[model samples]
Target: MPSDAYRDIASLPPALRFLAGGGEATKLILERDWSDHPLGPPEAWPDILKTTLSTVFNSPESMILAWGDQAQTFFFNETYFPLLGPRLGWAMGAPFQVVWADAWQQAKPIVEDAFAGRSRHFIDLPWKLDTDRGKADTWFSFSYSRVLSPAGDVAGLFIFTNETTERVLADAALRESQEQLRLVNATLEAQVAERTADRNRLWQMSTDLMLIAAFDGTIEAVNPAWMLTLGWTEQALIGKPLFSLIHPDDLSHTIDGADEIAAGQNFARFENRYRHADSSYRDIAWTAGPGDGKIIAVGRDVTEEKIAAEALAAAEDQLRQAQKMEAVGQLTGGLAHDFNNLLTGMMGNLELLQLRIARGRLDDAERFVIAAQAAGRRAAALTQRLLAFSRRQTLDPRATDINCLIFGMEDLLRRTVGPTTDIDVISGAGLWVAMIDATQFESAILNLCINARDAMPHGGRITIETANKWLDDRAARERDLAPGQYLSICVTDTGTGMTPETISRAFEPFFTTKPIGQGTGLGLSMIYGFARQSNGQVQIHSELGHGTTICLYLPRYAGDALMPEEEEAIATAEAASGETILVVDDEATIRHLIDEVLEEQGYTVIGAGDGAAALKVMQSGARIDLLITDVGLPGGMNGRQVADAARMLQPGLRILFITGYAENAAVGNGNLEPGMELLTKPFTMFGLTAKVAEMMKYVGG
Candidate 1:
């Protein structure tokens, strides 16, 4: 407990804190608040001990030292932590003998030797210690020397140790091998007498299949290892030609291998397949060499290894596909926004223009107005398809019977494709049910049939078939799908088949084999999105000049299809009813269009530029019968949050949220919240007015 002992300890000679174990060891020691330590603190250590311990703690080689007859531990470097393991925590500043009590006998002598003014060095000495691994046997090459006191008497044990277990064991094996060689030369005659029985025992116990085949490839000898690998008895295998048991696919290869080993030239490491007792193939890798005009071979079953390698390759392919889809979705998210705005303006203007023509104000411009309106509506449809392909489509999935769903579309398909094209609807017996949005499923079917019709120039056959399928792990991985029961609907057409290039990009949005302007390229992409969102998959199979087949795999739902009662459409006649409505949107054109249309219907409408403005209007005591707001707004608050805030002021506030994106977390499934209604943008005037009336009805307006 010398106060000045540590005062100059940092001043120095590498025996102080100049550098300990790469200069960072002492940093860890100083940063630690050692007030609770039994030794009080580093500041109170004796001068002679402080300087000597500091030098040992910093030495690059693993080192530790114990001071006093109590064996109070003083230092251990970072390099020595592995040797002490769990005991390291209590070993610092602790009695070394008690901390390493599990190895006390071996450790006591080393410490006592140093304290007795004697130094000891040993090579590859074994010591058992209670460590992290519990009673581990470790070996070290070490030297124990006295840590002398300032009076030149032994004060502590100075130890330097390095783990040499691996090196020492390797050296032992080499020496054993050398000794065996010397004995082999001295007893060559004795070994020859025992060789036959020894070889027979080794061959019987070996895990690798040992075989001796004639130069003509007739097997003369086989080991018990063959029974473990191929499950065939010796009597069943020995007389048979070796190539006969080889897999048919691998028989020719085996024959060629025999020819190579026939010339007495040794060969090694050839792989092929061998038939198992179960009539399946096990991949086997073999090593062969020439022995006394015969072929000596050793074979090992590698079936599991082969399967694992295949699965890894398939997983890597799936990862690459997922990355490509993610990249495409990100790039199109912005395009969806810009295109949605343009669509809103175009659709709003067309609606206004059509309204004028409907009022007989532009009787002569009716035809022109109708054409432009049709084109504008098509552009809006295109935008929706883009969103669908990006998995942003809002879906209302329910239990659906795909069998009845497809059969019910017969008349529509005939009408669309005409008489020259033949349509056959084939349904599976006891078809598995699926969970899908019925409306979207119908549209997807129509899209596929339309594509089929286009493919057949002279009008060929279009067949729609349904079947139940269960995909196992390997099969599912190949398609990047989960292993489960699935309902597959395949549409096949006798038409000009698509090339590999076309088939590869078949599901990509805006990618089509048809000439420009002839195809929007969104049909298959939209179907792909619908399937993915429904937790299903779409796959295409085709060969040039052999026609094409498009398959839609939907997850099988075990529950019976629940038929939702269709609600009679609300009449727009009572849409106004003198109710007040609040409309919030960032787009001026859309807001103005809504305000104009609703005002004409006799409802009082309040317009806001964003969520904030809408909240301000409500705060100003405006009576709102229905809240119609865009989910994404510019004033820092989205429609859902604004609606939530407004509800605090008026608990009975009814909400109707709209967005161009298929789905948003806030408005999922259009059930926004209690007293809330959900709608998507680019909606028809009739649809919009009907929704407003429905929400108003809920409020008893």
Candidate 2:
């Protein structure tokens, strides 16, 4: 079919061999065929195939041709001429095992597997070759596959090979770069995880209620504190509208905050109310801002804080009222003291005129003196009322049963409130006894009833109750009172109540909610001062459109009760004895009044306008049996200074100090010394005479 059958085999891709004449140097026919030719001497063929393969593959120029089942060597390429040196041409027809005994040891397995139809590959296979130049060491990647004949029978090994030194070095470099990248990625992942854990811990451990809400006011996330504080589970709050949990009064404000965030505005220090799990509203202060495409808000409950602020405001108002009352007391005390001195002078003059007229010297003058005395008595009563409001009125403390006190005054209270109002008295059988002035107590009850009557234009019930209460330390601390037993007398009326603002200023003098002239605001102020002076307290509770309750708390008598004294014996009486009296005062009217009163009492009176003049009189060696001086004097000398100078001159001098403004009056630094006496000025002649005689007796003692 062709020139030769071997030409068909040689025409394949791999190199092929043919025996020539005697087989010295072999012809390695690549891409050709010579099997149909007769056997000729090997020296007749040129070694061009081995030379060409070596040059193309850049390998050492040496080649071996082995064939048949015994793998006998038959030819050598001319490129292997110098490798054998002296035996080069004789090696061409030698058996492969004899020619390459050492190489066969390594190549045998590769050749056997390939011949059995298995492909074999090797990297960095080390080999040596001798050339005309020198012996050379090299590495190669070798692949071996079985060459098959046209009949599909194994023919020979076909080896494909390439040098691999540069590729092996580049492989080491690539592996190092991949390892470094892996380490870098690992480090970055660890850092990311650490930051995530830190953020999670911060979110969980916070005490403030934290929430993440969407732009539409839907709650997207909430911290544990939020759930715990609201008493809600995670699922209950997630995806719900945030305003649903807010108080009704606060929902609009909260929604506005969301609108602000969506508009790219931040809200700071927004305050509103939220509904608690217990169904009460809590004052909440929040700060909300946009964060990571969501609105993050933190809030704190401030309900107790708000209540405390309201209580503080109420207490401040009460303190202001108390201070106002104290100012009024100071004014009243000053006026009453000065007024009593003038009344004493008038009464003494009236007494002198009456004595003269009683002798039947002039009937008309006697009638005038009697009429003047009647007018003086009325003026004294008015002074007493002012003194009571000032808390300077003389008090007669007694252990009076509160139930009996209320019962005794029920008829008067009924008359005071009028026929429209019904009076009800609720008295506890085991009520505690209070030590208070009975006259002031009656006045206080009358004043409260009048107030209650004014509050109700229509008919209403008036309830008076008495109870025994033990005020513990905690209650006392809140009320600013001492811990002790108390007798409480509560007066309540079903009348129109006052607003908080009105109630706050209720006890302030001259502050009235009533139409002008319908009420005098002094009623409650007087009651407050009297109660406080009697070691008691007054509490008022009222609400708009609701009724009012006024409670009086008086200290209970804890020790053995004392017997009440006769009231008549304690009243002031005219003195009988007459003595020389020295009267010193800064006010000219006061000086003249004292001098007239003492002279009318049958005592020789010496008057000085001030303490310095009184001192001169004493230094002049006047026989002054008594020194009566106003506490506030001009010329840098007060009553006490004049008395000290006078007493130095006359060791047995009787002294009386009078005062109107006692708070500013010069007196003892702490307490009055024994035998030293003081008399508030707005007194009657009888009271003045009694005080003068009493001091003289102390001089006698």
Candidate 3:
């Protein structure tokens, strides 16, 4: 070390140079070759060097300069003048801790490390300083590094520092923003998952058959309801063409629907047939629409609706046919009565001639006598059948044990059903009795047996059973029946069962599933009419390839009569009387026949072609005893009105009304009152005679 290096140290400010004692200052000059003279004491040198270093670094207060082998305080720059309070120019030979007493405890470790050859780095250390200016909060970035002497040994320490508080706050704000963004993203993801789960639950819980099909018509997915509705497993439907499940006739439409869906069109509603797992076709109503990459279809089976529609149509047709038949019956009944009158006259005249010939007054022959009688019998039989069809024939109702009735007719039933079919009776002991017309019941049973026989052409078993049933109010409401005890006569057959279409129309008049001439299509219709007329109901159940069960529900007889043999016959004879009768009819032959029959029955008769003529005749003061008039009379006054007016003239007057067209709107349709008897047209001469006599007796009474 030369005196030249020592000279540079001595050139430092006096405050720093004074820190070096005399021996230290001399040692520094000798080691670093500073100015040769004994320049100053070591303390003075430190003070001078501290002032010089601060001036060189352009920092006033808080400046430090240290060199190798020195733990002493070296500098207090001109900036320290304000901080040192009235001792601004004081010598800088104080210890480092004493010089920075407020921060010395905190800075000691850093200072020590630096003197030991560790480089010091800046750090933000918080502190409060008491000064003449004021007490203030300050943050400092203090750095310390080792200084070297001329021999390269540790000599002193150097420190550089800065104040930094604003930078630290800015970093905290950035971290908060990042945390907020993470929360938003997490919430969005959670919402998406919840929505997906909700959608899956809704799809599973739905009851309608639902399916998702690909654009190519292959089934991509099906809900549990699909399997439940169609009776198909999930695996059976997957990857299968959706149209494959449609009925053959509906396959083309199904394909078209898929094409429309793929083209982004939605079908709001459509009806078609779908094949059930059991190979039957079910009528289905469905809505299909486009969805994400697929077609979604929802549907319900409407087979019952289709069946009910068919049944309604058939019922309407049967009603129309029944009306027609009733019209014909009226015509026939009138004709029979008129014809019988002509026969009565002819037979009376013929008997008179025969008696005259036997008394030897011959002329004309006996040939006319036989022909008239034969013709009369034939007309009577025709009238009877018409009456049967109309359900207007008199019934001989009896409390008949069905078991005996069926057993007695077993031979007849077997003969009627043919040799191939087997008849089985399963009537329970102590079976209930039904109040019914035995002949009609026999006819109905025979007709049913024949129908069953026809259904089983290849041979089958027919089971006839009779049982008592109590229909409750709830059940009655469901079935549209009157709640009461009923006698249920069931005829079941193991035969070729009818489809819904066939079964629905099975009871319609002239609507037959059998080949032409094989059936008249009147058997079931007749049975239905008979049941309804007898205050009963008929229900038929049949399924294709299964069997049929036809049940007849009749109100149980609550009266006393028990046996068919003990039952009394319906009265056919009319009351005897001789009262004036006025017969009004548009048909001349009918009018004349009625006049002749009534006159033969010992009642005075007057005829009229129309209601006006009858009224005019009555107004003319002819003492008409009974007004027997036709419902469909010419002019404004109908039979009912005519009877009303006639009764006004003659209060408490008895009327025997007649009609060829009973459905005449002017007649206020349905049956006439018991006091006003109705004689449907095309009746037998005997029927007219009896009815007229009955009315006369009623008036007399």
Q: What lDDT does the true structure give each of the candidates?
A: 0.77, 0.67, 0.67
Model 3 lDDT on a 0 to 1 scale:
0.67
Off by over 4 Å in 3: 1-443, 456-464, 477-485, 494-496, 530-536, 543-547, 555-578, 600-602, 616-626, 647-654, 661-672, 690-699
Cα-based TM-score, every candidate: 0.50, 0.42, 0.40
How many residue pairs in model 3 have overlapping backbones?
A: 67
Q: Residues 1-701, candidate 3, lDDT per residue (tens digit)? A: 43334335465455444323223233333234223323344444543344445342345335555433444644444333444442232324445665567767777787778777778677767766654445655566767887665566665676655455444433433453353234324565663464356445765677677776787888866767766677887789989987877888888887887888787675657788878888877888888766555676788877898899999999999999998798567555655565566677668767876786788866555555655666566545444434454565444466777778889999999888888999998887777678887777888888888888888989999999988888877566664679988888889999889888887777665557888547555567667766776778888998877889998888888765464434422233466456677788888988887777767767888888888888888888878778888877778778899888887777777887776543435455444454677666557687777666555655657
lDDT ranking of the models = 1, 3, 2
Output the number of the lDDT-best candidate. 1
Query: Residue 445 of model 2: what lDDT?
Result: 86
Q: On a 0 to 100 scale, what is the lDDT of residue 700 in model 2?
A: 60
What stretches of model 1 exceed 4 Å from their correct place?
Answer: 1-363, 557-564, 567-575, 620-623, 669-671
lDDT of 1 by residue, 1-701 (tens): 23233335454344334333333345445655678766666667678777776677656789877776564665677678777776654456667777777878877777776678778898889877676767656778999888677788677777888988667755754564454344334454653444345566876788888877887888866888889988987788776788877888888888888888786444557889988899988898998866556677888888899899999999999999998888587547645754665567667667777787779777556565666666667767777787779778777666888888787789999899878799998899999989887888998999999999999989999999999988987568877789999999999999899988988878877677787657767899999998888888999998887889999999999899764343233333354688899899999999999999888878899899988788889899977788898988886788778888989988879988888875467675444466776677778887888788777777854
Lowest-sum lDDT 10-residue window in model 2:
18-27
